[model samples]
Target: MIIADLHPGLPFFLGALVVLVTPLRYRWIPLLLTPLLGFINLMGWELGTTTELTFLGFTLNPVRVDRLSYLFGILFHIAAFLGILFSLHLKDRMQHIAGLCYAGSAIGAVFAGDLLTLFIFWELLALTSSLLIFARREPRAFRSGTRYLIFQVGSGVLLLAGTIVYFNDSSSLLFEHIGLTSTAGWLIFLAFGIKSAFPLLHNWLTDAYPEATPTGTVFLSAFTTKVAVYALARGFPGTELLIYIGVTMTCFPIFYAVIENDLRRVLAYSMINQIGFMICGIGIGTELAINGAISHAFNDVIFKSLLMMTMGAVLFRTGKINGSDLGGLYKSMPKTAAFCLIGAASISAFPLFSGFVSKSMVMAAALEEGYHWVWIGLLFASAGVFHHAGIKIPFFAFFSHDAGIRVKEAPTNMLFAMGLAALLCIGIGSYPWILYDLLPFPVSYLPFDNTHVIAQLQLLFFSALAFVWLKLSGIYPPELRSINLDFEWVYRKLVPTQFSNLVSAYQRFAEIAHRLWVYSSRRLEVAGRRLHGPDGQLSKTWMTGSMIVIVLLTLSAVLLKNLL
Candidate 1:
């Protein structure tokens, strides 16, 4: 009977439609309560629960509960609640609707027992989340939103194509481990890779996140890619290719984040770096590795949201987000600055932070699994991430030279949301087992061993020292007013420019062809007129004598031919 009830995530989807009719004054009730109800609904289901239906001649499992999906369901509900709480001051009904639907789609996707069910939610996630970007109501935002939609929708298309191939090949649609040896598997893997923001497939994130409205960025940071991560952890764990791809993801983004001027864009790049750690863990595929990967994902969504909220608060209060334009806001927004430092510490994997607990497991797993080079690369990436994201973000945005900008602190609701996130960061860091207990596999490893702690601390200390040395010696990259080109340049600039040139070239060729055609046509017309006109030689009276001579010559020629 309980199986007959609506899906846990359906409440949020239904809440989205309800948002339209709800009065503006009372909107927060549903915004806050929807996720709560969804969370409660998820709690009611037992592990191993199954719900089936017949759709289009196939028995479809729309809901299948297990540890993995349950963990993500809880994580998503928490993220949704925090995001809604942070946006309490917003009056934009469309954003509220979009955020709810987007969160619901992610929740639905993780619970989907069939690829077809997942595909439906996958496309919905793209459509709903793009609305947040478009909510900015600016031309630049619109363009960025369009580009974002292309990547997200393109990802869904790949999933659909891959699903069709996979189903045809296997005659089954269960969402389960699908190793990458078949055409369908590879196609699906690529689909997940695009959503995971893997390497060159990543520009959409940096292009879109900063362009979204402040609160919208917080929502944007939570769901889409993490869902892809879930898909990877579920379907392609232990794939060797992921290790190389993940390490590359970790290293390359550090360069971009270091030079990026927009604080939010830096965070966007940082996000890729964080995801790299998880991907690498999933690649390792030990019990410790999978636990580490998903747990990191859990911590990342929270801490990253905290960081985004701080930046959003800055933008909300001061109308500026570029590092070049912001500085010494600690004077007014001290609480925000404090919260930001916690976020920085958490993301940087400081010994007493959330990242430290989960990130170490992945590294330990790598070492145990004999991926020496991978472990080394991950170590380097850890140092690099702290250098840019950890040091650069807080230092420039809050504690750098005074830009002479004074602004009020973020609103109370924003602070409350951020404060809650900060507490979770500390709580999880201090007692990681609380989170560890919820992992799909039993977590038996301890993060606070003396040897590991000392090493991590040394890594952090030296990284800080190097940052200081660079800054004091004037070698550090300065915050500046400029645009840095990334891979998106290929499409945003190169492709478009070349396309314009092609159009111009075609126009020129068409002009020349038209001119030649007109000239030749006129010449033929003139010749026709001359030959047919009354004044022309062929049309004169002499034609009668010429005709008689021509007939005699023809007859003489015919007789000569016959004699021969």
Candidate 2:
């Protein structure tokens, strides 16, 4: 019997169903096994469209196994596994099921060769991932989850509208590069940009990710934005505007990272900065640049998740994650601290680290593309990331003055998750070729050249020195409980408050109008009583002569009309 290649999403989605129905005692088996199954199935895919369907005269390829899609499939599968491992100790079935479904949707989206199929998976991603946020069950989680849902679902709506318009205009459903030369394409691009967390559309990520349950944050940090990156790289590679937009993404987040009080929120800002690098690389679109973009994305999932896992550990242990509220954790949770440092160094792009290999490719590509200024901005961003994510995160949480709070080490499962992530960070860095070999394009770029190493070290060390100087001079911004304003203020604060005021005004107007209506009705009732009620005109007796005269006139008019 010939075995057919399975859809990359099947393991995750089917596993989710099994998880939902299986007895609690045996529920964990599927979580542990699902990603492996997905990975195995992904490896079996044979480099082209594998499954197709025709309905209503539309050709839909449910499985399109190309380099770009395949790469993303691998990443999603791996992420699902790590996410499951990290959450192993939790008893929340909703999280397990929702997270699996979310991963499945992302995997499914990548394999979709037609817009319709991609749209289905795209919306599923939004729905299932949002559940991770709501699973926290806190009121704050609920509110943030709602905002997250609105933005994400809104993106899906745009995607569907754009797809329909594009299909109508072009009479093609093949997913390929469609630059912003037409209405449909621009709509689709904007939809992708929103998911990618382009500058103004970015607040949802920082706002929502920090509010998610710890394990949920790990999953959130991995899939949603990366899918956008994949879509962009897939659908609009070499678009020149992305370079400028990507630069903006890189340069602006550093300021927020420096001042943000919530440590997880700082990581959120840092994520945007890192994604900026990838976007810029994708914009370049040289083989090297595209490889850089894809590899950096891969590297980011591991290190960023590691960082989130550590913060989650701290949150899990002491019930605090704010920099202002946490300190001296290395004293108790040394293993976690070490793992966090590895993640930190990797993110910082230190020599012989995962980030060092992938990020260098992008920087080198930027220079090669004659985007000299863009390269400079990315260079600055590199240092800024280290300043915030690499140094500030570990320093404030682990090495700073003790908060006098002592806690036990993270649970075994959490430690295992961190350890696995840490191993990947080291493994990828030590052997860059493992990741390089998997790049969607052939690799010619080298990250370990003497010039590259020296230049990166100088930039990173100088940035570290600035941090030290600022700290010694007492000029570094201290973590504050009061929130700083961001683009989200327009939605999270200003819009809601404005809407509340508008509603109050409307309610007051309704009250006044209601009172006027009541008064008018009373006056009309009084008039009726005076004129036509029991004691009024119609009820009173009239003189017989007057009544007869009236009746005679009425009869005369009627007789005249009939004669005419």
Candidate 3:
């Protein structure tokens, strides 16, 4: 039986079961078990069993299990396994349960047959993943987690709303080709956009990622954005607007990253840069482009997680993640330094690395599609990746300015996890077909062509040369202590500050008005009392019994005279 043929409901059930039975002491057990369960489900699925079903008025089918979703699903499972292994030292059961559920939901989502199924898993990812951020228990972490949840859950809501509109307009909930001209389609696109770290909507990433626990960052890096990329590919492939958005997403983050002091936050920027490539590929919408996007997603999960693991390990040991306070640690942690370098090389698209195999596909597709400007933007971002993530991360963290803090190597589990990921990075880079065969489309394009290899080498080598020149000439910006603001500044500072000022002004105006109203009303009440009192002019009366009798006698005489 093919793995995609297995019921999508099974993973959710098994994941929930794991959450229930796994104890706090062995919380990591569930995290470890989840991927195995996914693997089992994968093995049990048959291509023929891929079918669609409607339940609770929501159409769901595990219909598509082609190479694209398959590659992502398999990588997600692998990432979960590695992430769980790295996080074994974490005792937070909430993080453990949430991580498992989040990973499982991501897997389920990739295999989902329709929009409704995707939305269910999508929302679940938001809920569960936010818990990982909150697990840090820091005030910043709590606050950022709330923001993160809002953005994530908001994406799901948009997706749900779009699904409703789609069903209302089209009278169908089947997840198939969706055009961007309709309301429902745009809603879905925005929904995926939020997850894909679209410009302006992306602050949730840099805002929240660095706030997660050391181990939590490793897990955070792999799932959320990749899932969004997958959803975009599934729902909005070939949407032209994405090309511009993708370009913006890639270019603008580099400035902030260059100035960022937090190494993890810098990686967060690079994450967006990488996603831009994938988005560009999807926008191109050719078979090769789509295949490139999926393949890059596979490579990204591995190397990006590997990079995060290095940072996580460093933080785990030293409790410091700021780039300014770190340097020259490669002397003490040579193994870590080596692992980080491998990750850095892979991210930089060095020849014989995973990134070289995967990222070049997108560039190739762009050039093939005659998207010259798009290709140029991606090229510059690729160089920028080498600057911020490929070099800056490892350099500042391990080899730049010695902060004179000597820390021990990462714990055993952490090292093992990093080692495993590093080995895979090299393995995949050495033999591209190991991953190429699993892409959604047939493997017709090769990453190792002589022309492609020479061009990539030239691009990367020149970028490395630029970095060296900048560093040696003291032209590189020094990492600073103060936070450099981004889109989150709008929510974090600007909006709130404006709102508070408005409320304060309103409160002052309300108080003055209330006082004046009270004074005027009291004066009116006193005047009213005086006029309506018993001794007032309106209350005086003058009726005597004798006068009444005289008047009655006169009236009687007049009445008798008139009658006669």
User: In model 1, what are the clashing residue pairs, if there are any?
Assistant: none
* Number of the top-ranking candidate, with TM-score as the measure: 1
List CA RMSD, all candidates: 1.7, 4.8, 5.0
lDDT of 3 by residue, 1-564 (tens): 455545543664566577667777766666666678768777665543457676886656745676556767788888988988898787776776777778878887887877888889899889888988999998989999999999999999999999999989988877777869899999999999998899999999999999998888888899999999988887788988887888788888987888999999999999998898899888988888888888888888999999999998888888989998888889878888899999999988888988888888888888988999998998899888888888899999999878898988888888899999999999999998988877777878877889988998898788889989988899988888768878788989999999999999999999999999999999988777787677765566756986799899999999999999
Off by over 4 Å in 1: 1-4, 541-544, 554-564
Looking at model 3, residue 299 earns an lDDT score of 86
lDDT of each: 0.93, 0.91, 0.85
Measured by lDDT, the strongest candidate is 1
In angstroms, give how far residue 211 of model 2 lies from its true place: 0.7
TM-score of every prediction relative to native? 0.97, 0.91, 0.91
Total clashing pairs for each candidate: 0, 0, 6
Model 3 TM-score, all chains together: 0.91
lDDT of 2 by residue, 1-564 (tens): 022367778778889898999887887788899898778777777876558799788988888888888888888887888889999888899999999999999999988888889899999999999999999999999999999999999999999999999999999887889888989999899889989999999999999999999899999999999999999998889999999999999999989999998999999999999999989988998999999999999999999999999999999899898999988999999999999999999999998889999999999999988999999999889989999999999999998989988899999989999999999999999899988877898998778888998999999999999999999999998888867899999987799999999999999999999999999999999999999998998879899999999999999999999999
Native-vs-model 3 lDDT? 0.85
User: Residue 216 deviation, candidate 1, in Å?
Assistant: 0.7
What TM-score would you give candidate 2 relative to the actual structure? 0.91
Worst 10 residues of 3 by lDDT: 1-10
